[model samples]
Target: MGEAIHNVIIGNGSAGNGAAITLRERDPDCRITIITMGSLPFYNRYDLPRVFRGCYDWREILVHPLSYYDDHSITLRRNSRVTDVDARSRTITFAHNEVMHYDRLLVCAGGQGYLPEELSDYRGLMSGFGSFEAAMTTYKALPAGGTLVMLGGDMIGLDLARTLIDTGYRVVLLTNEYTFWPHRIAEDERDGFIQALGHMGIEVVDGVHPVAVEEGEAGKPARRVIFDDGGDVQGDVVMPSYGLVPTAEFMLGSGVDIERGLLVDPMLHTTDKNIWAAGDVCQIWSAEDNAYRFYYGWNNVRLMGEMAARNVTGANEAFEGLEDERLRIDKKGHIASPFWEH
Candidate 1:
C-alpha cells in the first residue's frame, strides 16, 4: 500500500552489476536503478585485448547484453555522472544538475588510471587500456607491427603487452617503482618476473624514469617517451600504467570517511547508515589487524559486490577476501598469476 523501496547503485562495472542483480532477486518489489558514467553496459575489461586480434565486435566482449537489465527490471542510466553524494540528505546530484533521492545506496564506482603530478604534462599524449573506448583508441592509433611504450608496468598492462606481442606488435615497458601493482614484488622475485617477460619477447628496460612525452621528428610518426636522463624510447602508442587511484572524489565533503579510499566496515557499510561501498572505491576495516586494507582482483571485487547487496537487504554477510593474489614464474620462464587469468 505504501511507496516501494528505491535502491540506487553508482557504477556499472562488475561490482555494481553484481550488486544490482542480487538486490533485484532478493527484493523483487523494490525499485532498482543503476547510474554509470560509461556509455555502454557491463563489459569485461580483461576482454578488451581481444580488439587487437581484429575482433572489433563490441558484443563479443560484453558480459551481459543490454536486454539483461531490462528483463530484470533494473534501470540502467548511462552517461550520467554523479557530481556529489549528500549522505545526510540521501540524495545524489548529477553533473546535469539533477538531484535524485534513494532509500538505499551502493557505491561501486571503482578506480581510474592516475598519472602523478610529476607526469601531468604528458597526460594528453598517454593512451589507456581501462575501458572499451580506451582499448579502441589504442587499437586505432597503432599501426601493423607497431610498438607500444608503456610508461610504467602493472598487471593489466603486462597482460596487454603479452597480447600485443602475440599479435606481432612490440612492447617496451619502462621500469618504475610502481611496476607491479596490487602485488608487491620481493627482491628475490623480481629477476624471475623480468626474465619471464623477456622470454615472452617483451622488452623490459630497467631503471628508466620517464619525465616527458614529445612528438617525433618531421619524417617519423612515432611518439617519444623522454627519460629523466635525456634518453628516450619511440613507439606508436604510449600508455601510463602507474596503477589505479580510487574514484572517490565525489564522496568528499559528504561526511563519509576516506583515506586512500572510502572507509567501510567488513559488511561494506560506510559510516553513513543508508550507504554501502564495495570494489576499488573502498577500504575495508579489519578489527583484528587494526588497519584498513584494499582487496584488488576480479574475484575479490565480485564477491564484495554480492556480499554488499545481501547486507543491504537485511542480511549480515561479511566479505572474506579472495585468495588470487600470488604471482609466480614457471620452469619455462612463463609468468603465471591468477590475477592475469581474468
Candidate 2:
C-alpha cells in the first residue's frame, strides 16, 4: 500500500499458504510470493504416513494443486530451497542463486534434522518422515519381517507403527513413559490400542527411554537400544519420529531475535518488525520472547500463514495457538480430529 506490493512468504507449506491467503484477503493489490524448498503443489505433511503405506499418490496427498495457486492469484517458486535471508537488504537468496526482494518477509521454514548422528554432520542422517520422496524412500526400503524399532510414541510414531504393521514389518516401539499417550489417552482407549496393536503384531514396550540407537540387534548381545531406565530393545533398523526441531538455521547471525524460532509478538512481527515467522518456526509461547513452542498438522500452518499475510499487508493480527488441534489416523483406518494436549 505504501510503495510496492508488500508481502513475501518464505516456504510453501500450510503456514505459508495461510499467510498468503490472509494477506490477499486483507489487501488484493499486495503481492504474495511463496518460496518452497520442496517440489510444487503443497500437501499436508501429516499425510505422509498414508503415502508410506501406499494408500495414496503424491498428487492425491497434496492439500491443493497448482491450479489452486493460479485460481487464487498466488505466485509460487517451488522445487527450490532458500539458502539465506537478508533482513537488512529485505531479500531472500535461493538455492539457484536468485535473490527475491521483499517489502515484508514471513519465514515458514518448518522442520529440521532431529535425529542424533555419529559424525559432526549427523544432521545429514536425520531424514524427515514427511514429504513424497521421504515416504517413498523409507517405506520401499523397509524389509518385510525385519524388526523396525521406533523411538517416540507421539502421533507420528503411532501412525508409523500402524503403517509398518500393515506393510508386514515387525515393530518394536520404545518410549520413556510407562504407558503410551499418557497425557490424554484413557484406560479404555489404551486397552483398545493395546488390543489393536497386538492384533497388528506390534510389540510396544514402555518406560524404555532410548539412550542410543546403533546398527544391529537390540540389548546386551547385539547393537541395541540402551534406555535411560537401563532397559534394552534389539532390532535391525531404528526409525525415530520424536518431533520436529525448527529449521531456522538461516537466521543465525542475522541479529533477528530467535528463541528456538524467530522471536515475534502475537502480531507476528519480529524484532525487526519487517520480518516474521510462521508455522513451527515461530516463538508462539508468549507475547514477549520467552519459551519456544510448536504444533503439528496443516491447520496451524494454514492459520499461521494467514496471520502473517495480514500482518505483512499492514493489518496487525494476533495468533492464539493451535494448542488443542489433533488430526491422527488410528490402526483401524479411522481418522480422528479430537483436540489433544501434548
Candidate 3:
C-alpha cells in the first residue's frame, strides 16, 4: 500500500465542516485536517445574533462538540489563520510562519463584513455581528434600551436588527447602496423592504451617505455616524453592515485565478488541478451566463462544501447550486429569503 492522501480544508463554517464530514465518510483512511481561525468548532453563524438575546452560551449555537471530530479521526486546528498558499509546492503557510503540505486542498474560508471606506478609520468604535466574539462584545456594550445604529444594513444585520428591537433595544437603520447585499433588487422591492422595516419598528433613515464616525460626548457613551450631507445618527453602538467581501486574501499570489473571489469551474476545481474552492470564498463559472457567479445562503454553502469534498476524493461531481437565493418582496411589503429562515 502507498501513503494515504492528506486533505486540508481551510475554514470551520458550514461549508468547511460539511466538506470535512463528507470527505471522511467517502475516504475512510485519508488524513483529514481542518484549519480555522476561530477557536470554537462549527457553529450556526445565523444564530450568532442569539447572543444579543442573552444567550452567551456558545454550546447552544455549536453544531457538533469537540468529540465528534476526534471520533472521526479528523484534526481540528483552531485559531490557525492561513497566511499564504503555495500551489506549486502544495504548502500552506500560517501566520506564525509555520508551513505544512497537503495532497489535496480546499478553500472555504468564507467572507468578512465589508466596512465602507468612509467608516474605515472608525472600525474600532463600531461593533459587529459577524463572529461569536463580536456578537458578545456588542451584547456587553449595550445597556437596557441602548440604541444600535446600523450604518448600512445587509440581510445579516437586518436580521439581527429585528432581534435587537424585540429585546428592548433601539435600532436605527441607515440605508446605503450596500443594503440587502448579495441580493440586488428593483426600486419597488427596495421600497417594499424599507416599508417593511418601518413596520417592524426600526427607524429607517435613507438618502444619506456616511463620511466618518465619531465617539460620543463625555459622560455619555455613544457612537455617531457623520454623513456626507452634514447629518449624523447617534446610538450606543454603530455596526457597519455594508455586506461581505470574500476572505480570499491568502489565495492571492498563490497562482490561482481570482476575480472578486477565487474562480472555480462547476466541479469546484480551481485553475490548479490539486486545489478546489467552495462557499463564499469562490465564484463559480456559470457556463449558461458565461460569467463567474457567487451563490449564497446556508444550504447552498453547505452543499458546495459537500460537492467539493466529493470531487477532492476522486469523484467528478459537478455542483448544481442548491438554492434559488433571489430576494422576494410580497404585495404586503414582506421580505422573504432563505437567508432569513433557518
Candidate 4:
C-alpha cells in the first residue's frame, strides 16, 4: 500500500478532515478524494454548544471552508454519501451512483447515534454530533423556556444540554451515573458544573431511565416522559446521544475485527492491510490495559489523524493511544483522571 494512486476518505467529520490534512502534508503529490455525508462546509461539533449559546458566529463555527481546501487542490464531494463499499475491488459507490476506485481507504466515519430496536417506536428521537444537520435540527426544534431531557448524559449530552439551556430552553439531563463529564471532571467538580449550569437553569436527573416518551397531540412538545422510577417529567424535546456505533457499518464484512470498533494494531492499521481507520472509527489498542479502546474525543481524533497519515504514506510511525495525562485536564488543574471516575 505504498503511495496509493486514488485514496478516498469516507466521512468528513473531524477525524476524516484531519486525516486529509495529514495525508496531504505527508505526501503532497498524492491524489486525495473526500466523500462526505453532509453538505458543503464542515464544522466542529465541539463548537456547537458554544455557538448555540451565543458564543461563536457561523464563521467561527466553521473549521474549514470549501475555498480553503479548494486553494489546496483538494476535491470535495459534499452531500455525497457512499451507499456501498466493495472491498474486494476496492471501490466505493456513492448515493449519486458514481463509482470511485481506491488504492487504500482511510475510514474516519465517526461514531453515529445508536437507534436500538427496543426503542424502535421512538427511534426517530435519536440524534448524534456527526454533522451540522443534527445540530440545526436540534436547535430549531428546541423551544425557549421548554424542558429538554437528554437520554444519554455523556460528553455529547452535557454539551448539547448547555446549548439548549443557553438558548433559553430549560434542560433536564438524565444519566445512569450520578455525575456527568465522564472523567474530565470529578464528582464534586461535575456537581459544581451541574450546579453552575443549574443556576443557568439546567437540571441533572441521574440514576434513572426513561420508560417512554409521550408525545404531544400531533403538534406539541414531547408532553410527558415516563420514568422507570415511578415518576414522570414533561419535556419539549428529548435527544439521545450516540456513544455506541461510530458510523462504521460500511466495514461490516471487510475483514476488520470490529468487536466494539474496528480493531487496529499499535500502528493504527486495521486488521485489513489494504484499509486503515482513524478517529472514532478505529479502536486503538490500550497499552494501559491491553484491551481495545475507542476514544471519541476531539484531541484523540487529531492524534489518530497524523498517525494514520504517517502509516498510510509508507512512514512507520507507531500509533500510541492518546496520552491520558493530556486528555485528563481538570479545571482546577488537578492530575486526577476525572474522565473515568464515577
Per-model TM values vs. the true structure: 0.97, 0.78, 0.96, 0.83
Per-residue CA lDDT of model 3 for 110-159, tens digit only, reads: 99998867568888888888889889988989888999999778888888
1-342 per-residue lDDT for model 2 (tens digits): 266565778777878877777777777676778878788578766667776466657788777765888877888888777778788888878779988888888888886535544322323322347677876766655555667677665556666676777777778876533224313555455555555555656686755456655555344322366676777776655567555668888777666888677777777777886888888788775634465555455666667777777777667768876555534446664434442321
Q: After superposition, how far is residue 36 of candidate 2 from its true place, in Å?
A: 1.4
Candidate 1 lDDT score relative to the true structure: 0.88
Residue 30 of model 1 has an lDDT of: 94
- lDDT by residue for model 4 (1-342), tens: 665477778877777778888788877778888778777566777666664665434566788765877765567778887777777888887778898888888888777666445555775654444456666666667666777777656666665665576567787776554234334454555555555545545576766667776676665566566777878776777776535466777677766778767888778888777788888777888787788877657777767876787788897776765555222324544223323321
Badly placed stretches (over 4 Å) of model 3 are 219-221, 330-333
Candidate 2 CA-lDDT value:
0.67
The TM-score of predicted model 4 comes to: 0.83
**Total backbone clashes of candidate 4, pairs 3 or more residues apart or in separate chains:** 7
Candidate 4 stretches greater than 4 Å from native: 1-4, 54-60, 115-117, 125-130, 177-201, 217-221, 242-244, 324-342
Poorest lDDT segment (10 consecutive residues) of candidate 3:
329-338
User: What TM-score does prediction 2 earn?
Assistant: 0.78
Q: Which numbered prediction scores highest in TM-score against the true structure?
A: 1
* lDDT of the structure predicted as candidate 4: 0.68
Who is ahead in lDDT, 2 or 4? 4
